[model samples]
Structure formats: C-alpha cells, structure tokens
Target: MSEALPQHLHSAAYFGEQRDFWWNHDYVALLARRLALDAVIDALDVGCGVGHWGRVLLPHMPRATLIGVDRERAWVAEAAARAAPFAPRATYRVGDASALPFDDASFDLVTCQTVLIHVPDVPAVLREMMRVLRPGGLLLAAEPNNLADAMNVGSARHLAPVDDRLAVVRLQMVCERGKIALGEGDNSVGEVLPGLVAAAGFAEVTCWLSDRAQMLVAPYAAPDQAAMRDDALTHYDNGHCIWSRDDTLRYYLAGGGLADGFERAWSLARDAQRADVEALRAGTYHTAGGGVQHVVAARRPQR
Candidate 1:
C-alpha cells in the first residue's frame, strides 16, 4: 500500500542501489552520533536494506545490540552477511514495519530513516513503532523535508516556467498519456516531516538538517546516476544504451515520438543540477537532504 520506495522505487538490491551510501553516509553518521544513540541498545531499523546503517551505528555502539529489518528477504540476507561480525550483537531479519513480529517492549530504540515516504500508511507505521518500543524507548524517525521552505518560493524566485530546453515541455506532453505521480510533496518526500512526526504523536521531537550531497564528480555529483557508488555504477555503464540515451528515446518513441519527452526532460533537470552541483548541495535539490528531520520521540502512554 505504501508507495514503492520513491528514492529508488525502480529497483532494490540492484547492486547496492541506495545503500551505495544510503544511510551509511558520513553526514548521516554525524547526525546519528548527535542523536546520542549510545545511551540505548537493542535498536531496530525498519526498512533496513543491506544493513548498511550499522556500518556507522554498530561501530558507535560496540557494546549494544543492533538489528536491521526489511521486507525484502534478499536484502535481509545481505544485511545479515554485512552484520555477521557482530552476530549475536547485531541481527538482520526480513520483516514488515507495518506488521513487525516482535514482542511489546522489544526494543529500546526504534528508528526509521527515509522509510515512511515510500510507505503508504504513516500513522500505521508510527503505531507499529510504538508497539515494539519499550515504554520509555526512543522513536527516531528520519525523513527529508522536501517542502521545508515552502514560503521561500518567492524569496528564491527565479525565471518563470518557460520551457528552456524544450525538455520540460516535451515531458509534460508525454505525461498526459501516462500517470506520473507528480506533486511538490511527491517530488520530495522528506520536505515537511516535522508536522507529520508531530501528528504521529511523537514527543521531544527534535529536528536537524543533513547535507548528503557528494560535492563533486562521480556517484553523487556525476549528474545522471540515481546516486553514487564505487562498484555500483556498472548498472549505468553497461545499460547506458538500454537505460540512458536509448532509454529516454524508448520512452519518447513509445509516447508518439514527442521530441520533448518526460524522461528526457527529467534527465535535463538532473543535468541542470549537475551543472550547479554546489546548488544541488546548497539545499536546492530537495527530498534527499538539505532539510530538517523532526526525529520525534514519544512514549506508549504508560498505564
């Protein structure tokens, strides 16, 4: 029911899709450290893929137990392998956040990172987090603030929406034929998360900003790839003809050969960001980073 993993909804475990850095980024690490997770053990990550976040967290909590859970069995297997060194200390499981198979008060820290947007039911997931967490446990939920600066639209106003490269124009024409889940909120899932966390009944809701852009060159900066990676880039290199230049062409031709096609225009927007990679990191590229995460924490209404 949740939207298919928006960040990399297209594919998963596709040779380390988002985990190519995913939650294992340096900034995310610093952010996690700032969260002071060391105070608690037996933490769980819903929607954990490849168990990469543990790379940063486990080392931080050498003495605490950590577990990563996901709906994908294959990813769970990979996550298990990644966390094997920790073994009993760290565990991986194939589970759904909406229906976790854990007993009440099973975890002292329950964390969800950029996982809610992909999911359809935010409240259901929040309740589940509460269900598994101990009475006084911490619920650490992190998502992007795509619409964080909604009022800043006028302040940072630029040129009117004229078709500059004819790319956007063409893409719009193509979109008329098929469904493209387009919306300011849709484009960037994490933009306005503070309000959502508040609504979720999370208290002590503290928020922080995270900048996750790679600054320059390959991976994060290389313009077109979903994100960056050392070995995860083979997908783009080998499938360039199939998914790159040719991929856009296929979408266009399939849509009556509209020169200004949707895929092509979207690619243009990515290209535009690459040109100003600085801006991309400067909070221009919403959704991924450059915003505040409410990271709300609340109790289960102790009785």
Candidate 2:
C-alpha cells in the first residue's frame, strides 16, 4: 500500500483552490498603497502555507524580495516549487512562527495571512515577527472573526428555528473556547489583533476589513460561486460540516460541553449543511456572504 500522507499542522482541506479567491486584486492593490509597500525591499511571510500569502503580496511590492517560512517541511518544499518563477527573489524555509530563523531587524516587511489563528501563543509569534522586522518596517496580518461567519444567515438556513440556530451558535462558541483552552488557538482572533499589536510596542497600528465576500446565488455560474459550491459539496461528501466530526467533538468536549448535548448540536449543524448542499443542487441557495476578515497593520517603532 502507498505510504499514508504525512499529517501537516492544519487540515488538508483548508489549503485548497477556494483560498485563491480569498481576496480581490483591486483590494490588495489598495492595501499595498495604504501600507506603503512600494518602499519594501525585503519581506518575510511567517507561516506561509504553500506560499499563497507571499505570492499574493509579490505583485504589489515589485521592489521586494520575499522569504516564506513554515513549520512543515512539506509546505516549505511546495512553497519553494510554487515560488520558482520568482527565482532568486523568493525562497522558502521550514521555520517556526514563535521563533523565526532570521536575524533581528532583517526584513523591511513581515506578514502573514490566516496564520495567527493557528498559533497557540499569538503574542510570542508577534514578538518574533517584530524582532525580524527592521525599525519602521511594516507588519501585516490577515485573520478572521470566524464566529461571525458561522452565525451568518444564508437563504437556505434563514427559516431554521431560532432555538436550533441558537444551539448551533452555542456549539460553535463553546468549541472556539475549547480550542483555545486546549492550546489549539483562537478561531476568532482577528477582532483583538489591533489591541495586541499596540500592546506589542508597534507604531501606527491600524486595521481594515477585506472587501471580498463569498456570495453565492442561483446557477452559481460565477467563478467564485462555483468554487464556493464545490467547497460546500466537498464538505458534504466528506460527511462533515466546516470541520471533521471528530475534531468538532474533541473541541466541544474540551470546551466543557456535555457529550449528549453535542449529539443534538452536531446533528443540527449537519442537517443545516445538508440543506445547504441540497439547496445549491437545486440552484436556490443564496447568501449576502458577510465574512469578517480583518487586515491588521503596524510599523516597528523607529529608533
């Protein structure tokens, strides 16, 4: 039999094509301007999974040479391959976020996307990112308040009983807390980043919301809509909602949820997922897609 695939730090399902549409080109360009990326000559992408985040930043910072680091050797190899087109200007290495490999004051910019959510000690990672960033260099992080996204009302689930909806929300909330309690990191860490950055002694801290949304409507013909539909269907086929049932159960239990209560909540959530897929198949599903992703930016204080 073929050797089993090595398990990386995060779920394999998360690193998919859907991530490609997470931001709009124009919005990223705007962010580049707002962050003064033109001045950057050396950049570091912490926890750079497959180099996606670093690739996204390249076009906006023509003067920068990008370096990507990840704890997973597999991801580093893949990132290196993906960054081949950029050659000498881009490189990837296996490194930890809490203790980056580079020297202090090494980079003109330090950034990460959806990375902090997976780190158990966000502050430690922030300090490491800051250490390698030169004085006056930019530090940018993109993260999401996933709890809000979980609570969004889609057309298919709008008519769910209030009690049922509330149960699902409670399940997610408790699981988020449980994840943190278990040192798995926070699912909704985006909302607190600005405060954390300020407390970390960064200067000119600021935050912005991503302009991209995952709206899906009938026919689902749009490229993004099709990607969304495929993502939903993939989850349904895999017999889980956003996370695998086993993982959800572990988090729920860790968060102080009763075993019996999890059964009901999980059932409700699974039913909702099924309903979404069915609605999508019938071309009747729709949602405004108000996801809450925050882009937090700060500059290392000048000496």
- Tens-digit lDDT string for candidate 1 (167-236): 4444434432221122111213455555666676766666665454323232344432345332223443
> Local distance difference test, per candidate?
0.55, 0.87
| N/CA/C clash count, model 2 | 0
- The C-alpha stretches of model 2 lying farther than 4 A from their native spots are 1-9
State which candidate has the highest TM-score.
2
Model 2: weakest 10-residue lDDT segment is: 1-10
In TM-score terms, candidate 1 sits at 0.63
Summarize candidate 2's per-residue lDDT along 43-97 as a digit string, tens digits.
Answer: 9999998888888889888999999999888788877887888888899998999
lDDT of 1: 0.55
Number of the predicted model whose lDDT against the real structure is largest: 2
* Positional deviation of residue 86's Cα in model 1 after best superposition, in angstroms: 2.0
